[model samples]
Target: MMRYSWLLSTVAAALLGSPATADEFGDPEAGAKVYSQCKGCHQVGAGATHRIGPHLNGLFGRPAAGLEDFKYSKSFQRAGASGLEWHAETLDAFLENPRSYASGTRMSYRGLKDETDRKNVIAYLRTFSDDPANIPEADPTATPTDHDIDPVILAIQGDPEYGEYLSSECTTCHQASGGDDGIPSIVYWPEDEFVVAMHAYKNKQRKHPVMQMIAGRLNEEEIAALAAYFKNLDN
Candidate 1:
């Protein structure tokens, strides 16, 4: 009896662990209705063109400010330059709070506070993107790969005093006050995100010339130190 019960539990667990279907994310039809609020500033589907905001076609998998012809805000430009890409996770974060995500953006709408609305809107936008089956790696439906930081690197306890001294080079463009001008603010970022971003730049996964140069010179300890300092800057 115990063996049979264990077998049943294993089968149930396997079923529950199966990958979610695309529809599970949200309903495109419901999303279209929710997207009415965005109609004034944006457009999607065939014949969509730039309105007050950039057209939403091909939004998934696009980098922040990816369109060449359309001019983007300095904050968005900075975000793109820093290797920010538009995936499900990123879009969700941006939709939850637009201004908080990009402080210098021209987007005036407050944000979609409802999680259902955000998911639905994202689903609707996904319909306009390329089919995931064709471009499995780059498509929005594909799961994003997290940066594989070594355990030793992540475990390193940084010296903030050393980081402060090293930060002079960064402060020339990034504000210490967490202000976003033409450049995106680096202060008060979560240490893990900051470290991962820097490593991305260092590894040439992120494409900014200056960032690559700066990050390339820093060792693991230095990177951790910078991460620690910037994360606690507000404190």
Candidate 2:
């Protein structure tokens, strides 16, 4: 089944000419500009080598912490041990929030909050990998439908004190100190993004049974409070 799927994907890519040309994947030219933020830590293209971070050449299809010479954080090592592989979709998730995806990752960049930036950067990085033409163009796990949150709900001013009181249930899984064993660390997230994520769960636009149930119980103000609390938890 795996071989058959691979063959089908390859054929589809051939039909599409090159995955790079697909706008859904992103514009490499634009990505070049976005990639300036990453150049300091990573090197790519010809003659690239490990620096603060490993050279990103041939990153796609490589397992997490794949470089034998580079020392990776214990969190990344664990992710690799648990069979993590780099691909467009996985990269998108990680780039959206690095610490959340791999709790103890040494990469200090907060993350690209803009979806387009993440896509474009991934597209740019794809150029350094072998067989960029065959790489997938879209994230299959992305939310299938847009969940339009009400403006009023988004604008609500939350009480962080109340959020702290209500966060006991949340802290059970998500550590208060920003440590993520398996569950993602919620500390220090921007309030708006946190609110949006909880709403996504509440609306069932994002999948996760436990999250959905918790979000379902929270009113708009309560969600905002939680967002407010988490955003400043690290502070």
Q: Which candidate leads in TM-score?
A: 1
Q: Which sections of candidate 1 miss by over 4 Å?
A: 1-23, 133-235
Candidate 2, residues 62-135, lDDT tens digits: the string is 88899999999886886777566776666776787676566578999998878888778888887887763543
Give the clashing pairs for model 1.
none
How many clashing residue pairs appear in each of the predictions shown?
0, 0
56 Cα displacement, candidate 2 (Å):
1.3
How many clashes in candidate 1?
0
Can you give the lDDT of residue 142 in candidate 1?
26
Lowest summed lDDT over 10 consecutive residues: which window, candidate 1?
138-147
Weakest lDDT window of 10 consecutive positions for candidate 2: 138-147
